[model samples]
Target: MKKTAQPGIEARKNLDFGLDANTPKYWHSNDPFKTRLHDALQSTFPEGERYFIACVRVFNDRIEDPKLQHEVKEFIHQEAQHGMAHTKYNQLLAQQGMPMKRLLAFHKDKTQKDQKRFSPEFNLALTAAFEHFTALLADAYFSNKETTAGMDPKMKALFAWHAIEEMEHRSVAFNVMKSIAKVGYFKRSCAMVYATWMVMYFMFSFADNMLEADGFSKWQRRKMFFKNLNWMYGYKGILSSFTPSLLRYFKPSFHPEEIPVIHNYPDWVKAYDESGNPHKACEALIAAAH
Candidate 1:
C-alpha cells in the first residue's frame, strides 16, 4: 500500500465570542427525544469547541487564509455560544439525574485521541461532515411546522435560532480545509465518503449508549430509539439532504449561498431579547418538573 501523504493545514485567529448564560431558550426542558438527541449531538460538542480553539492556538503557526480565517473566527463565535446554550439546557437535563459526565468524559478522550493521531486534514474533514449533519437537524427543527407548532414558544425559538445559524456557518471547516489542506483528490474524496459513513455510524453508537442509561424500560426505550431512527431516516427524505451538501464540496464553483436556506423564523426569537431571555413564567414549570 502506498503511504498516504499528509495534508497541509493552517491556522486562523480566534474571535472573541463572549458567552451570556441567561438566554431565553434555556428556561425549560426541550422535548425528551429532542433533548436526548441534544445530548447525543452535544457529546461531540467539545471537540468542535476545541477545533476553533485549536485553530486560534495555531494561528501564528502557519500562513493565514484570509476568508478561511474569518470563517474560522465566526464559526468559533457561533460554536462558543452553542456550547454555552447547550450547557444550560444540558445542565437542567442533568438535574434530572441522568448525569452527562460519563458521556462527556468519554467523548473528550476520543476527541483528544483524534486530534493528536490524525492529520489536520482528516480532523477538518470530519468537522465539515458533522456540520452538514447539524445543518440538517437544525433545518428540520427550524422549518418543521410540526415541531414548531403548539410548543413552548421559547423552545421552538431555540431550535429555530440554532437552525439559521447552522446554515449561516455551514462552510467554515471545509473552507479552512480548502485554504490549507494538501491531501490529494483521492484522499479528500475518501474523507467525505468516509465522513458520511462515520457520522451515521457514530449516531447509532451514541443513541445506543444513551438508551442504556436514560432510565427507560427495555421496550419503551426500544420504541424511542426507533422513533428517533424514523425521524432521522426521513427527516428530509433518504440521505439526499446530506448527499446534496456533500457533493457541493467537489464542485469548483460551489459556494455557501448555493446551499438552500431552511427557514424564516417567526419574528420573535431576536426580538424576545430584552436580555435575550424568556419570561419568568418558565421557572415554575421547571421547578414543578423536578
Candidate 2:
C-alpha cells in the first residue's frame, strides 16, 4: 500500500467552549434523545482523549520518520486541548446533575486497567480504531445537515471545531500503528471489532444513564432507545452516510486519507484562519450548508 504523511496538525491551543448554566437542558434542538446521546459522548471525551494520547505516546520515541515524529507531538497537543475542553463541558453537565464524577471515575478506572492489561501495540491499534470511529463521526457531523440542523450555537461551534481537527489529524494514529508499531492486518481488524463493541457499549450505557436520571423508567428508556435508533441508523441518519468508510478499515490496504474529507473542510479552515475563532468557522459551515 502506498502511504503518505497526514496534513499538518495545527494546535488551536487553550480554546474555551463557553459552556455554562445558560446552556439548555436539551441542547440538541430540545430533543431529549439527541441531547442526551450527544451529552453522553461528550462526557467521555476527557478520559477517552487522555487514553488516546497515552496510547500514542507509548510508541513516540520508536518512531523514526521526522514528519511522523513532529505530527505525533502536535497530535498530543491537540488531544490534550480536546480533553481540557471536554473537561469544562463535563463540569457543566455535572452542575446540571449528570453524576459526572461516578461515571467518569468508572471510565477512568477502566482505561487505567486497559493500559496495564494490554500490550502497547494493541492499545495503539485500539486507539487507531477509535480515531477511525471519530473520523466517521466528524464526517457525519459536517456531511449530514440533520445532525447539526437545530444544535445550539455554542454546542455546534464546539463540535464543529473538534470535528475539523479530527479530520485534520485522523491519519496520525493509524500511520503510527502501521509504520511505527508494524502491527499486522489481523490484529488491526481485531482492534476495530473490539473498539466498535466498546464504543457501542459505553455510549449507549452513558446515554441510558442520562435518560434514567431524567426520570425515565427502564421501559421508557428502552422505548426511547428504540425511537432514537432511526436518528442513528435511518437512511439519512448520521451513521448512515459512512458505512462504507467504516468497513474500509478492515481492508489490508486501508488508509484514512483514502476517504474523502468533508467538502466544507477548506471553507471552515479558512474561516477560522481569517477570524481566529471556531464559532466563525461553524458559522461558515452553516452558511455553506444553506
Candidate 3:
C-alpha cells in the first residue's frame, strides 16, 4: 500500500454545539432511527475516547521517535477534547429524556471490565480497531451527500468537524500500536472482529432503548427497525460503502493511512480550522437566533 503524506493533528479547544429544545428529536436527516443511532454513538464517546487515550498513553515511554511522541501528545489532547464535547451532547440527550444515563453506565462498566481483563497490547489493538472504524465512517460521511443533508446546520457542523479531525489523526493509535514490539497482525485482526461486534451490539441496543423511551408505538418501532436496517445494510447503504475499507484491516500489511479519505482538510479549514474558536462561533449563532 502506498502511503500518502499524513495530515498534522492539533488539539483545538473551546469547541461547542448549538444543542437545545429547538434541536429536532430526530436530528439526523429528521429520521427517528438515524437520530437514535447517532445518539447511541454519541453516548459512547465520553468513555470510549478516554479508553483510547489511556491505551495509547500506556506505550508513550516506549516510543523513541520524537515526531511520534509529539503526535501522541496531540492525540491525547484531541481525544480528551472529543470526550468533553461528547459529554455535553450526551447531557442534552439525557435532558431530552433519552436513556443516556443507563447506557453511559453500561459503556463505562464495559470499559472498566475490559481494562482489567485485557493486556495493554490487546487494549491498544482494540483502540486501533476503533480508530479505523471512525476513519472509515468519516470518509463515508464526507462522500455521501445525503448523510448530512437534512441535519440541523449546527449539528451538521459539529459532526463534520469531528469527521475531519477523526480522519486527520486516524493513524495515531495505529502507529502507536506498531511501535510496540508485541503488537502484530493476528492480535490486530482479532481485535477488529471483537471491536466491531461490541460496537454494533451496543450501538443498536442503545438505539433501540432510546426509541422505546421516546414512546414509539409497537408498529412504528417495527417499521423504524427495518428502515434503519435497510439503510445500514441494503444496497448503497453504509455497510456496502464501508465494507471495503473495513476488510482492509485483515490484511497483514494494513495501515490506517492506506485507506483513502474522500474529503480533504483544505476544503473545510475555513469553517473548522485548528486555530478557530468554535465556541464563540456557536454562541454568536445562538445569540443571533433570538
Candidate 4:
C-alpha cells in the first residue's frame, strides 16, 4: 500500500459535552432501539479504548517511522479523550436510571480478561480489527445525514466529534501493525471475525438490557426490533451501504488507507467546535473526580 498523506490527528484536550437532565432518554430520534444501540456502544468505550491504548502502546518502541510514532501518540491521546468523554456520558445514563454502571462493569471485566489472556500481537490485531469497524461506522454516520439530523444536538455533536476523529486516525493502528510485524493475513482476518462477534454480542446485549429496564412492552420490543433491523439492513440502512468496505477487511493485502476518505471531514470538525469545545465541556467532571 502506498503512503497517503493524512490529515493532522491531534488530541484536543477538554473535549467534553454538556449532557445533563435535559438530554432525552431516547436521544436518537426518540427511538428506544436506536438510542439503546448507541448507549450499548458508549458503555463499551471506557474499557475497550483503554485496551486499544495498551495494545498500541506496547509496540510504540518498535515503530521506526517518525510520523507514525507521532500519530501513535496522538491516537493514544484521542482514545483517552474518547474514553473519558464516554465515561461521563455513561454517568449521565446512570442518572437516568439506565443501569449503565452494571453494564460498564461487565464490559470492563471482559476487556480485562482479554488483556490477561491475549498476547500483545494478538491484542494489537484485535485493536486493528476494531479500528476498522469504527472507521466503517464513522463512514456510515457521515454518509447518512438523517441519522444525525434527528439526533439531539448535544448528542449529535458528541458522536460527530468522535466520528471525525475516528476517521482521522483510522489507519494508525493498521500502519503500526504493518510496521512492526509481517502483516499476518490469517491473524488479522481471525481477529476481525472475533472482534465483530464480540462487538455485536455486547452491543445487542446492552441494548436489550436497556430496553428491558426502560419497561418496553413485548409489542413495543417486537415493533422496535423490526424497525431497527430495517434501519440496519434495509434498502437505505447504514450497514447495507457499509458492506463493501466491511468486506475489504477480509482481503489478504488490505490496509485501512484503502478505505475511501470522508471528503467533507472539515465540516464535522467545525460542527463539533461550534457545539462546544470538548475540553471545556468536561471541566466539572474533571474537577469532581479529583
Candidate 5:
C-alpha cells in the first residue's frame, strides 16, 4: 500500500484545560454515565499512550521516508503531550473519589505483560488498531454536536482538543505498520479484534466501577450499563454513525486518511492560537460543523 498524505501534527505543549477541584463530579452534562465514560478513557491514556509510543518507536530506525520519519517524531511528541494533559485531568477525577489509581493499575499491569510477551511488530499492529479506534471516536464526536451537548466547557475543551489531534495524526501508527513493519492484512485485522475487545471490556469496566462508587447498586448499575450501550449504539447514538467506518478496517485497502472527518481542525487551531482559550477553540470547532 502507498503512503497516504499526512497533515502536519504539532504538539500544543502548553494548552491548559483549567481542571480543578471546582469541576463537578459529572463533568459531561452532569451525567454519571457520560462523565465516567470519558473519564474511563482518560484514565487509560497516560499509560496506554506510552505503550503506543513504544510500539511505534521500536520500528523508527527502519522508516525510510523523510516525511513519515518527521511525522513519527511529531507523533511521539503529540502522544506524550496527550499523556501529560490527561494525567493532570485524571488527577482531578481522583480527588473526586473515583479510584483512579486502582483502575489504572489494572491497565498498567496488562500493558507490562503485553510488552514482555508480544513482538514489536505485533505491538505496532496493536497500536495501529487502537489508533484507528481513537480516530473513529474523534470522527464520531466532533462530527455530531448532540454527543457533547451541555458538557462542562473545560472538560469538553480538553476532549475536543485531544480529539483534534487524534484525527490529525490518526495515521502515524498505521503508516509505521504498513511502511516499516510491513504488517499484513491478517495481523492488522486480528489486532483490531483484540483492540476492540480490550476497549469494550476496559471502558465498560471502568465506567461500571465509577457508577458503583457513585452509590448505584448492582441492579441500578446493570440497568445503567444497558442504557450506556444504547446511548452508544442506539439510533443517532454517539457511535451509531461510525458502524460503516468501523467495518471499513477489515478491508484490505483501508487507510486512516480515507475516513472523512467534519471537525474543523484548521479553525480550531486558529482559534486556540489567537486566544489560547480551549473553550473558545471548542466553540469554533462546533460552529464549523454547520
Candidate 6:
C-alpha cells in the first residue's frame, strides 16, 4: 500500500487538525484506582481503531461515493492517530504495571470476536449509528469544562479536537452505509438499538475490568465507577439530549448536524481551503504506538 500523511487543516478540504502532541498530560499512574481506569481505556483505543480500519476497507470494498471517500480518508487519518495515541497511553499503563495481555483478552479481543453476536450488515449499520453517537459524545465532552476540571489535559485536548472533527465529518459512515450496504429502515432502526446496548455494554465492561484489577473492595470500586462516570458526564446532561434523537432514526429527514455541534464550531471552518492535502504529524500516532 502507498502510505501517505494527512494534509493539515489549511491544506485539506473537509478536514481540521486539533492535535498538539507536545501537550503534557498528568496521570497518577501509581494510584491503583486510576491504573484500572487506564487499563480499561487502553483496550478501548485499539478496539475503536480497529473499527476505523474496518471502515477504510469498507470504502474500498463498498463505498462508491467519491465525495464521501475523501471525507473517509480524513476520518481515517484522525482515527489512526487516535489509535496510536491510545496505544502509547496503554503501553504507559502497562509500564505502570498492568499487562495488556489480560486487557486485550477482555476488551481488545472481545470486541474483535464480534462475529456470532451480529451480522456484518447489522454491524455496519450499528457503526453508522454509533458514529453519530460518538460525535454527540465528543460534543458533550467539550461543551462543559466543570465536569472536566481535573482531567489530564492531553486526553481532554485529544477528545476536544476529536469532538470538533466528529462534528466536522459526522456523516461519513452513515453516508457510506446507504451507498454500500443499501440497508432498510427496519435494519437501521434495529441497528440503532443494538448500537446503544453495545456501547453501554463495552463501557461498563471496561469499568468492571478495571475494578477487578484493583485490590480495593467491590464497594469502593463501585463508588469510584459511578463517581468517575458522573464526573465525566456532569449531571449526565449529554444522555438526556442524546436519546431523544433516536425517535428520528427512521424518520428519513433526521441527520447528525441536526443534533448539536458543541454550541457550533467557530465560523472560520466555513472558509477553509479544500485541496484534499494530508498531514503527517497527526497520522504519525498510528505506527508510533505500535
Q: How does each model score on lDDT? A: 0.53, 0.85, 0.79, 0.79, 0.85, 0.55
lDDT of 4 by residue, 1-290 (tens): 55455678968777646788888889988878989988988789889999999999988888888988889999999999998988888888888888887888888888889888987888889999999998787667755455455677778667767777887889888887777954588888988999989988998889888888899876887788887787888876856868788888998877787666665565555544565564332222222221
**Candidate maximizing lDDT:** 2
Instruction: Record all residue pairs in model 4 with backbone atoms less than 3 Å apart, i.e. clashing.
Output: 14-278, 14-279, 15-278, 15-279, 16-278
When 2 and 5 are scored with lDDT, the better candidate is 2
| Per-residue lDDT of candidate 1, residues 1-290 (tens digit) | 12222212222122121223333322224445545555466555545566645643343245376766666666777777666665665565456454467766766776678778877767666666567667666544444345434345555444445555666676666556555664455655666677667556655556556655666677876787676565456656424435566676566444444556543422323333333443222222222221
Better of 1 and 3 by TM-score: 3
What is every candidate's alpha-carbon RMSD to the true fold? 9.0, 1.6, 4.3, 5.9, 1.7, 8.4
By TM-score: ranked, best first: 2, 5, 3, 4, 6, 1
* Model 5 CA lDDT for position 64: 83
Best by TM-score: 2
* Overall local distance difference test of candidate 6: 0.55
Instruction: Decide which is better by lDDT, 2 or 6.
Output: 2
Model 5 lDDT tens row, 104-191? 9889999989888988888999999899888787667777677777788888888888888888889899988988999999999999
Regions of candidate 1 where Cα sits further than 4 Å from its true position? 1-34, 55-67, 150-152, 227-229, 235-255, 263-290
- lDDT per residue for candidate 6 within 1-290, as digits (tens), equals 12123223211223323323432323322344443554464457667667755844654656666766677777677667667656666666555445466756666566666633766766678777777777776545455543344445455444544555666666666766676777677887887887778666765666566556545578887787676554344455445545555555657655555564544344223322222222332222211221
**Ranked candidates (lDDT, high to low):** 2, 5, 3, 4, 6, 1
Residue pairs in steric clash, candidate 1?
A: 8-182, 24-278
Candidate 3 residue 55 C-alpha distance from true site, Å: 0.8
In model 3, residue pairs whose N, Cα or C atoms come closer than 3 Å (at least 3 residues apart or on different chains), thus clashing, are: none
Alpha-carbon lDDT of model 3 = 0.79
